[model samples]
Target: MTTESLAEPTMRVRPGWTVAVVLANVGVFAAWFGPIQVLLAKQSEALAPDNKEFVFGLVTGIGAAVSVVAAPIWGAVSDRTTSRFGRRMPWTLGGALGAAAGLLVLSGAQGVALMLVGWCLVQLFGNAVLAAQTATVPDRVPVEQRGVVGGWVAVAQVPGALVGTALATVFGGIAVGYIACAIFVVLSVLPYVARAQDARLVVAPAFVLRDFLRGFWISPRRYPDFGWAWLTRFLFNVGNSIGLLYLFYYLQDEVGVPDAGTSVLVLTAIYSVCTLVTAIAFGAWSDRLGRRKIFVVASGLVMAVAAVVLAFWPTWPGAVLGAIVLGIGFGVYLSVDFALITEVLPNAVDRAKDLGVINIANSLPQVIAPVIAAPIVKHLGGYPVLYLLSAVITALAGVLVGKVRSVK
Candidate 1:
């Protein structure tokens, strides 16, 4: 609660700054879906086609568990940091470097234990960078611009996925792809770190351990809007992860694509276009209309329908259509939902810490979704039933978002 806690919002977000953020986000996500997840899927396939989903779930689920703890802890540390180099930048630099090291380790890993160790490091350091970077949005951007900024973040992710997949395709070697991802992350993040300004925090009474612990516990009863938003985010992210985490294998196993790589790229291309358009358009429109909840609700419903399509069709065409629909819904939701979360944050002084707490909603789902889906995909009717479950959960997320009283 010192004067040190407040960040001076930027007067206007420069185009260059926006582009840096976009590229950084792209590189980060590319590292994720591009190399890490794809590598896991390939390894699982190598081990056993029948056990691919289970193996992937086990690896990714374990890694994501680290993120559930790492993200918030990183954010809390950033919130208290009084570094002249600025609070977020130090973490940003350290995280990117740490994650890159982890990726290198992963590239050379010869055994499951080594791979697990590397991936866990990647999740830990990667989420540290992510928590700090995302906190900058609320720290810098004005309310009116947040939706558009969120759109840019979402749009960056679309190409990040496409480009990451493209890199993997072109490299065709696991080590090469991992190296490329590492390079992209470091290069993409530098411009922002060097050029952007972060408010220097001045501590009055020195940091306290007790205060830090207390900060983590934001009472749901006191901040119902934040609670509701968090719940909605958790549900929606879980739904989304279940659909995506097994997509590579789904193409190979379910749709029977001989070489799933080209098909995945094609599907990602379609998804990219749909996502880019909806993120920009819907994001700006929501800003103009002064509405967020409706867009969020609609997005969840759209995702539900898309999941239903995949469940029923289970073909290349159905997968393509589902990707397109999922992209559209995901785009709009990504654009507006973060803005809503920032609006509902219970405290300004702990913005990064609080956002990190909200980020748990995101990270926890990544862990939970795979764990949940592994069982369902194994015991139930395979990928189709998984998609159906996604549909049900996603639709329920829409209803959950409607319960938030603040930030209409």
Candidate 2:
């Protein structure tokens, strides 16, 4: 800890910085990941329909798999970096620019191979910022204030997703939609780069692959709550992604919208409004309650129950209602879980890196679930089975979260 940090806590500095980081994440989400959500859902319809779903899933999975593998190395690098601008800001700026370029590449993709390459780049470059971003909280904020910090980060997600959704209508279609998103990423990184306090900590590189590769072999048994946190994250993302992957489709197929363009706008609006309302409330509450595990477990169970309702009745109202309830649960989970992870984190010296590692559990399930869902839908039946699977898997994730005994 810095000597300045050791002085009696100042109300002015920390909260503002934390809020800036959260806003940056909001910007990244709106501009970077938001545009891609629609493409991920609808791309198969245009690009070799028979294989598009599976291919998209594979690309995302492979990229996410690569992320889990790579985040620690990037975190380690950031930990050691001593750039003029600050360790984290330099990484964030570079990653944001790289991600913007990746989006342009993805926008121009003509075939599956090119698209996959673009997607891979997005995961690698974009997360370079994300790793640094997540780590900054640990480096800059007092450990005790993590819940409030996490709340800020959680609140950022809704606007980001909503911004992307808004672009479709304003920009007119997928092509212009993605272009608008790129604008958001660029804008989001600039303030942090400009305002980010120059961190004085010195970081030095460790040059062995074993340093990064060894984490997988380390058992969470060593950290009792680690397994629970990881599994809950996995289950939550799986169920969430399955439902999300179909939002654009559901609006068209179920809502019977006349214009495809309009459907995109409608879904985005609904998603944004729902998310904004719930995430704000739940995120703030979790911080106040200081009971992360119970909130997470309850959220997961609620999610599973909502999934069951949707699975049985695949109508417009059912889907919308399910989306509302599911959104509430997800909002609660999303708002608090990361804060929860920060508290139960296994190692202090490696706090940011471990949180990044656990985050993989969240994304990996996303990659795995859709890869499995595509085939089941194309051949076995349709999204019903996928919904059921999502419910079962997510409920299992709740059970795992129940296993966590620390950090509550």
lDDT of 2 by residue, 1-408 (tens): 333211223243465677678767876677544545666445546777766566667766776776666566666666556565666888888887877776777677777787777667767777777778887666665545655576567657777777766764566555666667777777887777778885545444454677656753447778767777777787778777776665565456645666645555555566556666766777667667767777777778878877887778876677667767776676767767877877676655555567667768756765676677667667766767777877887777766776777766
Candidate 1 minimal-lDDT segment of 10 residues: 1-10
What local distance difference test score does each model get?
0.82, 0.68
Cα-based lDDT at residue 402, candidate 2: 67
TM-score of each: 0.95, 0.89
As a TM-score, model 2 comes out at 0.89
lDDT accuracy of residue 369 in candidate 2: 63
What is the lDDT for 268 in model 1? 91
Residue 162 of model 2 has an lDDT of 70
Model 1 superposed RMSD (Cα)? 1.8
